[model samples]
Target: MPPGVVSMAEALANVNPDALHSTQTGYVLPEPALFVTSTLQRQRMFLHHWKLLADGFLYMLGQEPQLLRPQDWRAVLEGKMSGYGRTAGLQELIRPALALCDIQTIQGLPVPVDALPQFSLRATQEIIWEVADTSFRFEFCALDKRASGKQWVAAGWAAMALDERHRYVLRTAALMLDWTTHCTRSNTIHRVADRCPWPPSEMQALETAVCEYYTTAFYEYFGRAAVIPMRLDHDAEMEDMEDGEI
Candidate 1:
């Protein structure tokens, strides 16, 4: 574990699992559903899922400099790749997030003139329009949707805002998972928390928000079972019951 990263167990010690459950449980499960019968097991499954997402996000942070300082919004909008994005796993992790942004382009590039903000003025904190040598003016904005009862807040240039939003969502999800797992290492969890862009309080709030969002999403995708695998002991119990019946 790196310095400052809190292990998943330590972080999850403070999380309330009941707060992570969803009311809706009628949706169809995705193919190859994860199956867990207990809240603790479900929490573990969630943590494992989040770890995969965190690995993908960290890979992008290290491999794609353009994601942090993108000069060409068009390329990013088109799902352009440089390093880890070329890999199969990372690509699967990132593509859906990138698809959320609405990019308007003409002739394979963004329009030269400034367009309306993708979000409402009330939803934005700051806006920037930079004129490039190509006579194109690039628009970027810092958004604060929290004022309107939304959970996300992020700052970046152009399409990068979408990336920031998705990154925030993933990080918050990871934090929530960390709070739910008891087996995580302390140093590892501390280190993970240390890398977060937001302060501890903010991250906590974001974790609550993201957890709520994902809980609903998980239920919708996996139904009430959430598709986590049953524990070996549970299987043993089932076997015992069958033997007695026979």
Candidate 2:
């Protein structure tokens, strides 16, 4: 709340405690996991995804295709092809995806991933997206069992929700690189043509190569159901099921 820094207490306060427990049926991080960061990283991650999601939402609205709940549809954004990394333990997996997009830009801060709050959905995306965007040098620690494949590929369907500019692909590329901390602790491979998420007609051109350029370093970190998916109701209005009173 102080300028760019948003506390876990403040971020979690936005969600209903009940919803948090209910949504995380499979895997949920233990309490006291807060991803603190500079105001700049926080703001950077928030605005970057906000603009992307906003654009995707508007594009989908105009296309009038059957839409998926933000959570369900967002899952396609997860998985290995997207460059989402996996750690051996639960705690390490939940670490914040840091910002390495700009090494010079992030001169004083520790990696942004360390400070990400678990339940803030938008915040998580900010973490991942920022990690993807920031261009930095050096490597990050790993969980275990690193991958040999040194390439990257963004999951195909994950980008379906996005626009033609392949914003999600670019963001996913950034995520794979930053999430794995330059492949020090994780084994994220960037294989082209293997993770195509577009229609057949859209394939065979730059789109094919474009889709292969990104990968998910870790999906569950950002898509945990505990962080209630932002809901869109019948009236075309944004509804918060965890409206604080719940």
Candidate 3:
């Protein structure tokens, strides 16, 4: 394999926790963040490996690394993994899993949330409050609908080109991870405080939190401002991107 793939493969091989325990639900990985700076890098690598890298980061957050197939996220997050519970009962994702970690505290969060091309400060702020909120009064039925009026869709890349989607999600995930690192396994995703679940499932939510750690790796290589930003309208713009509107 070429050096880039070799190094990335090696890095993925190195993404394990400090220790293991039957008593533990998940662990905080201590490795630095590993953000990918260019769309070329992603285009070169195999998608499954990229996904494993994604899952590995999720595992670092004490979440179900199986983002597409979340099984024990709620039980683990809610502290019910030790006993029998329903995996499909509350199929929503929250944030902050644990183990050894290369932490990026929320204190140094960048001023420009518009760095990631497809993301908006408004959307980021909305989810931050949504995930942080602990009240049933504002409870959402699904992760996709958790944000405002289904207007600011988190997965707004549905119609974007594959390459564009990869670039957008990667950077957006990184920026979010950087800002929310302070809340890892230490926040209010508690059982009684409130019940906030991500639509589709908790996998997307957990996936967002987990990306924080891996995005650090990108910063180590390319500073934090690498992911370019752009303003977009969900219905009008994203659809246009698919039709080569941009």
In order, the Cα lDDT scores of the candidates are 0.29, 0.28, 0.27
| lDDT minimum window of 10 residues, candidate 3 | 134-143
lDDT string for model 2 (49-116, tens) is 33333333333323322323333322212211122332123112221211112122212232244543
12-76, model 1: which lDDT tens digit per residue?
A: 23444454443422211111222111443332332233222333333333333222212222223
Leading candidate by TM-score: 2
RMSD of 3: 20.9
Please identify model 3 stretches exceeding 4 Å from their true place: 1-199, 228-231, 234-246
Error of 1 at 192 (Å): 15
lDDT, candidate 1, equals 0.29
Model 3, residue 113: distance off in Å is 31
Superposition error at 27 for model 3 (Å): 35
100-187: candidate 3 lDDT, tens digit per residue: 2222222222213332123233332222222222111111111223212243323422223434644443333333322322223213
Ranking by lDDT: 1, 2, 3
